[model samples]
Target: MAKISINLATGSLQQEEIIVGIDLGTTNSLVAYINPEKNPQVINDMGRGILVPSIVHFNEKGDALVGNEAKEFLTTDPENTIFSVKRLLGRSYNDVAAHQDTFSYKVIDDDKESLVKIKAGNRFYTPIELSAEILKELKSRAEHSLKTPVNRAVITVPAYFNDSQRQATRDAGKLAGLDVLRIVNEPTAASLAYGIGLDPSEHKTIAVYDLGGGTFDVSILAIQNGIFEVLATNGNTFLGGDDFDRAIVHYWIESNKLKEAELQANPGLMQQLRLKAEEAKIALTTQNIYNEKLGDIWCSITRITFQELIKVRVQETLDSCKQALKDAKLKTTAIDEVVLVGGSTRTPYVKQQVADFFGRQPHDQINPDEVVALGAAIQADILAGNRSDILLLDVTPLSLGIETMGGLMDVIIPRNAKIPTKAGRQYTTSIDGQVNMKISIFQGERDLVKENRKLAEFDLKGIPAMPAGFPKVDINFLLNADGILTVQAVELRSGVKQEIEITPAYGLTDDVVEKMLVDSITYAKSDVAQRMLIEAKSEGEQLVYTVERFISKNGQVLDEEETKITLVHIEALKAALQDGDKDLILKKADDLNEFTRPFAERLMDLAVSKAMKGKSVD
Candidate 1:
């Protein structure tokens, strides 16, 4: 008898493998799996406990440390110990600029279009890389606990995470030596932890209100026949238990008449107070009063005063719940279940307020911190074809794309997109009288096609000759239920067309595919660094080209000093690109853009005014 395989993400045939579930959190991370007993269990990593602090520290010799070992550096080595990195994922300088100072470590302030990076030791690390470090720790824990080579997983992220953030999470998993099959939403996973969608004939509408250490989001889901669909989600990524701790910190500071500068000057004192506040938060959950001091720093608060200080934050969450309900077109009474998730849900006041608002006690029999991971394990089981009660729609594992000019990867169907899906984007020629347009298809997360796996290529011939950026070319990707990909390109003006069918994994053995997956994780850091460098260099080169062209075309519009300053900054950016530092290149790029933005806007206004003169409304 021959054995058949299954592709966990797409439901296509492939080699079977054990799939783990991961919850890559801001303050802590963990891994879980459906064990031999057919129960989802969190990996303890030889009695180290479940919650692995989402922290990384560098030693005197620059050796990276993760989890509990890194936790000790929070106060001693605040500059090199990074925590709560999830808030920085897929974010730019402008995204978190207002609160950048809150971080104990340095966050690079550069181009708003570029993703944020942090400075730790001699190197710069993006949030994706920092997050991958945490995931790597979790992966090791799972492998040690299972005593097997754990290579595949289903990871959970916040429902409100945008495409970039979701992709970043997937990339982090890849970097952590795991083939991320699916990126399940945290709220959906929380619901699954309680077996809310076990019965195929059942129907329910529920709200998952998750307030974790660093983020909060409330999702309204409708479950019918084991299918969970999110109706609405709303919350603050910057709001959570961390804010509650800060409330205590600030209260103590005010009561003691301590200046903000004094607290800021003593890193050890701040970290101690923060830890004390955390202890106090947990203590008040079971006790009415928390009175303690950390190295002369008082951390004392009554349960009522603690509640009073964070009452506004809790109300903000309630307002978000109301907004989510309103958007879902459902009332509080219509919600059948209110699921509380995340470690912060242990707070009695938070629980009571939610109960009061919904007029029902929240469902939290399962541990809030582990709920998402447990749910993810259930999702993995479904993917493994272990659950006949639930049906899963087909999906694509990696994004499918084609190579564009400057070696950029232009995506057609992003990863995790439902199969039998068709999405197209219009393109245009970059040069005058351009004829043939080559379509090179590839798949993976990197921004450049060179870093991804190339499937095939074809050319759309007989395009009507036209000026640059004028020819309308429509490129479409149609993926079938079997995972076969068909790419088509057509010229709307001339009706010239070309198409190709690509079997994404054609002729690739299971070991080869597995090797590729492992290779992606092994070279993850260098690949991401290379990709960022390429992106910065590409943008800088393009800007330099545009500035040169603009000077050639409209040099008369600028003063000598303006022209000189612009040219000098352009040269500086060009030099920074060769410095081989992605952050520096991006910084210079931002500087140049800022210097020219006002003058460019002024020039545009003048041209528009000149064109609008004597023009009247029809």
Candidate 2:
């Protein structure tokens, strides 16, 4: 009877859900939607909460595991598990080659293309495919949680990510079978989450300092009633918690006399060490010392010592902050409140440094880890026309230009310039009877071509082969709201247009991504066990090297009881290594590290006291 009289306009079926926002990060990824109540809620996958670790693991059954489950296997099955795939997105083999030693994955050179090949059992897969697997998981999560098909989304990226990187991110979204409406910068997304609204007078200027798991970004924004405009943004794509982990790992190795060769042989050892180092860094935020038994390694690390080792990195974040302020032409005092986003900001030392720099305490009102995703959701609402009172106008983080006559970079769009902007330059033939014009695009603030990040290269053919400077070619560079570059060239004399189909020199191509998926699925079964063995061997080596170094360097200073404890840990680790039980080796490593806690604390206190004396000069 109700069906006969029901009006569709008054029923639940009458309304449709709009768009959603996604933060596709290096360490983690999340999706959120704006509900009918105008509240942003994170969508969970299969009853799990928000905040999915951006990781993927290929199991022996040819099934792919993503999120937290995948991250758990990172050290245990490193060869089959891939994390931090975001860093390699849109990057060339050469761009990531020098830093291959830093990542856990194996990078293979395929002619000119650099491929991230994950070895599992008897098979290997590329980075792009692995990334797609993660994306697919995310898509499924959103669809299952919302109980509605998620066809469109607004994904956020690093402000400093170049055109190629941006394109790669878009490709990933496409592979996941979702329509990517727009690619917003991470920092700008955070500002939207703040809900400054479009009142220019209320918040004239604001700064977003984002230190995420694998990257750091600083963005200066100016809000005019409902318009959140990004004035300038800059950051190190490779700097963040990951760097801090490496710094501490370096300290652990040097202090314990860990040999480089041993670490090379046992890759899993480094992963374990990195995990411990991260824990120590986090613990130091609230306590004076971090004490724990890592597997078999007994270690006590002091906050003061950890701070000393990471001070330079902390300073670097501040430097980026200052530069952002300078770019906005605003003083530190002009900033009403400094908004800190990202898990790294949880560090007390980092918070204190930011306070001292701005002469004010940073706002901790928002959840550091969830703020970016929240902001992205807010932007999604605005883009879907669900929220009209908010507008986000973000800028390009780096300067966009082309190479000039002397191998110099000529800026067409200066860094920090407003978005949806276009600029054009005219070029003439270099030599007599020149047939075509060559254009090289770069993204950076450097005056020299080599100093900037090369984006793409294209040739404008079909020139009339005119004498030296007769033919005129108009080159135009267009930067969209998402900060991607679209270039075009027109031969003025013949009204003929020639343009280059720009592909990122560093990121994955569409064909490559498809190939990776097939390979990952094919080799999933055999790779799991082999990957574990390799990782375990690596962890064992790291433990042995660290203990040997610690004993050699601090032996003379240890008392009888301390020496006995140290010896016990060392002997345990050594015994485990001999047996080739990766788990046991790790357990012993933790015990040894714990035994040296007291000594590490004492050394840190002394070092801090000495350093403060130098810093206190008026």
Candidate 3:
């Protein structure tokens, strides 16, 4: 008989490859893998801990420090340290501007429909890049513990996350050098962790109540024949375990008659109190009382007092549960299990309230903090072709997006998008007097586009020479049942059009597609940086062409110094282009554009005046 080793976690055959699962959370994150004993375990190397704080610190030299090492900087150097960046992923400036004061870091308010950027010292970073730092930390931990090349993973995200947000998570994974095979929902992963859906013949309907550090959500899941389907999901992104900590602080402030402005003025003191409140919250989970103080500030609370402070917040979760049940159209009696997840579930009040609401004892057998990660490991194992009992659905393993301004990718069709599905969004130019737009299609899971598997590239030409953003370009990607993808772009205003048909996975064996996807992530960071440099070079070449043409035609219109400076700046840009540095190219491009902009505008004015010089009025 031939020997065959089975990974019980994923029900898949164990090969040389290892696919771990990652629980990338708002408050904390953890990595998990199936042990040799077949039980899934969270990695805790050198007792650093299972849960790594999702905090990042930027040193004076701008080197990023992540997780526990960076947590202390939240109070000391809040401006350069960022936490809860999950909230900012895929979010535009307008999406978070109202609460800008909440962040100690400088979240750039560009005041437009563009992705937000964080300015850490002199450098600007997008949320995708910052998130990569955290994932990189987790990846290092996994590699260190396993002593192997841990390149592939299955990461979980909030069920309510939109397509863009999900793409952003995949991108972060890629940037961190992980081939994210799948993006599982947090609730589904939690249910898997508790061993709810492993038995294909067993059927059950469960509600997963996930109350993490910064968010709370309830999901009603129906499990049938090894398939877990989410019937409905509901929650408030603004409510979670962090609110409990804040509740204690709010109660203390009210009872002590402390001024909100005073607390606002003293961020250091406020941060101290917040951490103390968090300690009190955790301590009250097992004990009835917790007491502490910082100088004159009294941070003391009993379990009963803590329950009162969180009463409303707990009720809010229950309400969301009711709504989820209603949306799922299932009665409480129909639920076979209630799974508790998230670090906040340790609170006694939460467990009791959830049990009462469901009329059954919620499952807390698994460690709530680690359940999602364990579930993810199981999913990863399944992806490795280990599991035979589970029925899997076919999906496009990666996201599809078009390269947009600044080398960023805008996902039109997200990863796991059902096959034969078509999705698209409109876009416009980024510069004034722009006449054409280049649409480059890519297949990958990263936000920073590594569109090396570019399906096709073509220009939508003949756009009216108007101000930036004047033209409406609608790019549509249609994938057929046979896996042929036709990417089409049309300028609605001017009817300028172009498109190309390509088989994204054309004639390639399943193994080939899988390898390409893995390689895309393994080199995602370097790929994106190289793509940026190429883009800069292309733009520099285009500028050179345009400037030379303009100077030749209008040499008689310019003064001697005007002509001299323009030629000099143009030469400098050409030199920078040859140096092959993206940043240098962009700087030279901007400088050249700034100097030439007024001249171009002046030319336009002159043409308009010449046309109307002798025309009658009115």
Candidate 4:
């Protein structure tokens, strides 16, 4: 066999395609790629450092500046500098309504059900659009550093992210002009960076505790045959190192005895104190105490006090660890390794507590903040098919589908299907002469539609009117490699079609998703029974409507006895609909349909005959 030659200068594989990995974080974001040396490396553009503050600012002319450039305006133009945008991604106004006071920038409360929008200067921006701005900057930095046009990337999200949040990330990547190859979970990416699943024959189980600036999650993963599977994930989207900073701020405000009204009135002073608190939090990591001053205000905090303030917060994260273990159906002893991933894990107290809780020393050799990105780069390399020894597969955590009649969830892609998969099912009109079909997409494992989370809704119009159940409406769900979904609805006979990319920009809150899953498990039997009753009730109601409408139009054509018999059947169905009895409702509806079929057919034949009387045979 001929030996492959290597170019040592650029450290890139021969004829290799460069694909970057991105950690589009809440507080900061960065990009990385595998170098020609075959090692994953983060791009440092013009020596600007690896971490880019995920902040954006707009000027009077409405020009946008991102990263470090936009960080300075957080104090000077607090209303225009947007930060912590990742928390708002895939979130509705109501989902973040409780934390509205945290942002200095304007988060417009347009509609509770709609996605949150930020008002910068005179423009309104969705989180997907805003996140794209940050991703674009990361893209530019990668191209500048690597001296190549980088177009494809693997992006990481929290392990507990619902389908909506994951899709929102993919949309942002698309908006940023990057072909997002995969949406990797932070825990899985961190594990990959640590080489936990690199060896195909070695099997391991681990827990990844990720506490970033604005979010925290603990994931239990089982790696077998070089394939990593996420068993369970738990955490809060609003808790992180930023909260530790805030705890210091709260202590200083009390130490100085400063009035809340004063801080509220003076945004500049608040920003100063906030920034100072951040400094103290970092300084106290090594030093016993931290002290500083801002004008007339004194900022002081001891390491002991700092730890005390964050004790409950740290415990909350540990509580999540317990829950993750519980959800995974594994004891802590089952975990063979514990990995740390996130900037906040640098805190000595956090590291010690995590270690104590796990009964072992957690792996922190790699930089917590950069490990996720590095892992993503490695995944990109694998996707490039450079590594034959590794195999990684990701699955959707919840079932996804559309709402059917009687408020039932008709699952198309069930939970645990491998990503980049496609599934479809055929549906039909519920009523005769129905020309339009409404498709409402939902995500959850519940039997009833109302019990699940609604992702998006659209109408498949222009369907040809036909007898009930005669039209075939094929609904297909295409989930790409990135885990983003595109829904297509087609009328097979007429070729009338409608399709929508399901981007849940205003997604449900983290708690709601978790609750939906739990409820699906806890109340599965009741939900199914409720669904059947609702279906029976719906059938009865529809039959009543049809019978009444028929009488209004053709009562004169029928004899008195026929009209009376039809009225009796309609009454029986209506009574069954009210009684809430499934079997009785179905029986009554069927009785009415059977009684009226002959008359309905006779009327149709008569109408055709009348029309034919005035026309010649073709």
Candidate 5:
């Protein structure tokens, strides 16, 4: 055998290829790469254009449909369509199962795998599997668009995603056969995006208000000399555009005298209403009022009306923003510029709210949807050793700690501490004859262990038995550049190292991720396709069912021609569903919904009447 040669410097035997950056989101995903000229650019796939909707549809043929194609099937196959997989990444089944009602997909319980299974036709899938499909689709798009086989990438996650969720996101990338070099926070990535066009000498404090499809994040940063430091950050993992859509849907149902259960049962109608609501929200940005005709349902909404409806939700965002600024020890006036990130910020009402809160107009120069991805690409370039001039110093979003006496949390690393930082704490045996000491680590702002999120727990073993308070254990916690924590323990007297295994309290383990990947690949083809067919069939059934029910309940409210047109569109949708054609199913669904414009209007009127009567009664 030839002698092996090892190079210790740089920890590489040979030069590595350049890396890319990916934004794997709840509602959409995008891939960007640094070109040879050193500029970052997003790679657009042929079929799906630029941004891929983070929706996966398992069709009848067991094929997985991703992006817009999959989103189109959500209404028809609500049971099999999986969106917002990001929320489930690295999370336990129990953690996400409680919020199943918030999603449009069917989440089945799987005790054996400790996974949340998504039901699609005859098959079931774990959250990791669904996320892997989206990741794979993104990988394919990046490779095809770049015309090169890309291997290395930097992926972004929510700042508030627990250690388990972060690990899950990394596992998804691994399952998709991509090497994730680092996992950056979404808001930090947005800051990087803004830094690209900005002057480093500005040395100003910037606030990023990022409200995306399924999450909201607010981060305050201080920039100077090409150094970007995240001072503080806060967000709700379960809040975003989805919530706004739900808020509007609630308003419509109450205004039209529609039953909540009826809306829930009819996925097609829900889709229609969500789509209309989203349109109205966008329209309110530039126009004061807009009219929507959904089949026999016709309704008009003004900007003021939309503002009043979402005022509470908007206020919540403001509150979080204020809290983030407070945590950073800065006031609104201290912020030099407020950059808005995320698609949901396109709403004029949201812009106005942000402006009023900050006492200044929000910046809208950059594309909200693309900014985060662009920033991620820049970070990828830095990791690829292409941009040594720039450096990013991000902070921990939550405090890391352990449980102490009285169930109180003893904080180790306080939140907002700079990354690649280390802290050590010394502990002594509490009882006589103690041979092992367990350290439970928690992350969150809460003072109690039960209130905060438990990040991990590890035991330091192989300790000599000692009298009470005699044994000394030194524990060191280090957060790396990726924001993941690592711990080490050393016995003071013996100078011996103890085994330390971190068990995340809320995140999935590596073993679980591997199993999920295997399962997803095993049923990748047929399960996805079958799930799609089921969704299409379901949408068709729902549209026809809702239309029929509406006609039966309010037939006298519509004229003869209006009734005939509505019936014709319903028949068309029913026929399309029978033939199992997705395109036809969608077209007819839209047409029939349009024909019922008058009925929809009457329904809103009835809902308003009921609300007014309830108020009087109260």
Candidate 6:
């Protein structure tokens, strides 16, 4: 007789390993795995439910609380509770400045171009760290429920996520102690869960419309011979179910004659109203009217009126669908199927609208919320060599990037990304009257390019002479199926272009690639710290230059005391930049920003008033 190990917690035969699938979502997250019965199933640990709210709260002890435990802090301690962190990942301060106020927590904007940071309590955190906490919770739940060690995973991201965002997701998973085997697109995963690509013989062109709590994206996918190729993707990162909640909140405020100032002053009431609005949005889905009240504030809406409020917003998503089709260069008639994903699709109007637009009924057999995770599980099984019929996509063995300001390795195509892919990012010159831009390509995982392997270098010649940050340089990397890389650089404004080809893995053996990967992980902490410091110094230098130039031109606009204070702050930042302390440099830069913001606004107002000096009003 042969003896087999058993998992006491699950009362099942223990496997040697398990590669779980994780949907690290905006509003909620969940983990799934292929069970012993060869079925993809979500883990519901201790009956706590499958969906974990993507929220993290920092307590007085400075410990992080995630998921359901952190949900309550959204009202009681909004400043310490972080939600919708996915929106901030791989985004600069300028990228999300307009929407920063929507987040209750403080988002640090040291420089407009650097990645956004969150300040919860006294400590500053990147979106990657916050997301890691959520991933850790999911990992713990999966391990507990499966009664096995789960160290590897397949994570999903939005279809429109760029290389930086994808890399950020992978780093977050690494921080959570999981070796991310692949980053699958959410729409692609959703299609897999619906069994659309289970059969290699199946050929179809489908559209996946995903509208989550904080994000919306429509992806056009063409499946042929078990390969899922994304033709195009379009959506607004900030437009989603949250906007629907906001619409209801605005209607209530207008209907009840509530003051915006009062709501701003009373956060608890605002949170209550927001939450109630969310409830009403859900209730109106099945009922004709949803009526409720919090204290003296009446929250009321009819299904008809609710739909009317969100009609424009819903139309916006439909327009995105149209744009996606246009980008894919396909007609509505070309679409063989439409898949509805995300919890927002539960709304009757959204489903019907998508169905009508596609000229066919959409697929929603799988739960919209769990579809992506289940699909990820299936993919994980394939990666684990359990499925042979489905083909596993080939991926790049290492990250591919270029050297940006401060010699930072700005990854444009991350490691483990599916091959035969292309991605690009915009860049700008750093000096005045710059005519030529250097493009240095590298392959490795280090934060700085000098430590990575340089693949090629070239210059984008004939750039029109212009001031710093004026030229729009787009660098694109296209990796073909045979492991050949083609890099193209173009000055978008002038159409001055340059292209080069290189073999990314030429002369590199498996051991060398493996060593590079190991070295990157070993130095991940120090590399990130060094990269952040360099970015801080670069930001400080840019700020100093901008402030000095402003002072030189607009000295007369400032009073003596104002000018004196501004100069002092500028000098402080310069001094901090001279030192190597990243935090101090950021602190001084922030001080300068705070001091100059009011006068900056005043100067703009004066200019506007002068321009309108005898003009008639609209």
lDDT of each: 0.83, 0.69, 0.81, 0.81, 0.70, 0.87
**Candidate 3 Cα misplacement greater than 4 A, ranges:** 1-15, 201-204, 253-268, 292-298, 326-334, 397-423, 429-482, 486-505, 509-522, 531-618
**Per-prediction TM-score to the true structure, in the order listed:** 0.80, 0.61, 0.77, 0.65, 0.63, 0.83
**Candidate No. with top TM-score:** 6
Q: How accurate is candidate 4 locally (lDDT)?
A: 0.81
Clashing pairs in 3: 11-386, 11-387, 12-386, 12-387, 13-386, 171-446, 171-447
lDDT of 3 at 435: 91
> What digit string (tens of lDDT, one per residue) describes model 4 on residues 513-559?
44554455457446645765775576567668767877997886789
Write candidate 1's Cα lDDT for 1-618 as tens digits. Answer: 224344536633354557888998888888999988999998898899999999999777777899999999887888999988888887878888998877889887544545787878766678888888898888888888888878778999888887668777877776666767788889889989998988888799999999998888899999997778889999987899999999998899898788878877876787777878899999999999988866666678999999999999999999999999999999999999999999999999999999999989999899999999999999988878788777777677667888977787766786657778888877788666899998899886566678778999888889988875678999989999888999999999888989999888566564444454445556766766677787678767767776777788778778999999999999999899889788678677767877877776777877877778955422
For each candidate, how many residue pairs have backbone atoms clashing (under 3 Å)?
A: 0, 50, 7, 3, 47, 0
By the lDDT metric, which is better: model 5 or model 6? 6
Per-residue accuracy of model 5 over 1-618 as CA lDDT, tens digit each: 212121211111123565778888878888887777877788777755778999998888779999898887876777778888877775555887668788876564422123345667656565666887888888888877777767667888766765556655665665676656567877778777766324556687888898988888888888777656778888787778878777777777777778778867876887898899888777778899878777755546888887788788778889999899889999999988888988999988898889998988877877888877888888777655566565435655445777754465555665434566777667676555888778787764344467556666777777888765567778777877666677777889777565343433245433333343233334434433444455446545755776787799778778898889888888788888889765456556656755675687887787788788875311
Q: Rate residue 573 of model 2 by lDDT.
A: 75
Off by over 4 Å in 4: 1-15, 108-112, 259-265, 392-618
Cα error, residue 399 of model 4, in Å, equals 18
- Candidate 4 Cα RMSD (Å): 18.6
Worst 10 residues of 1 by lDDT: 1-10
Number of clashing pairs, model 1?
0
Screening candidate 1 with a backbone cut-off below 3 angstroms (N, C-alpha, C), the clashing residue pairs are none
lDDT of 1 at 505: 57
The regions of model 5 sitting more than 4 angstroms off are: 1-18, 35-38, 60-62, 104-124, 196-203, 224-229, 250-267, 391-459, 462-618
Least lDDT summed over 10 consecutive residues: which range in candidate 5? 4-13
Residue-level lDDT of model 6, residues 288-343, one tens digit each, is 99988789988989988988999999999999999999999999999999999999
Clashing pairs in 6: none
Cα lDDT, model 1, residue 412:
74
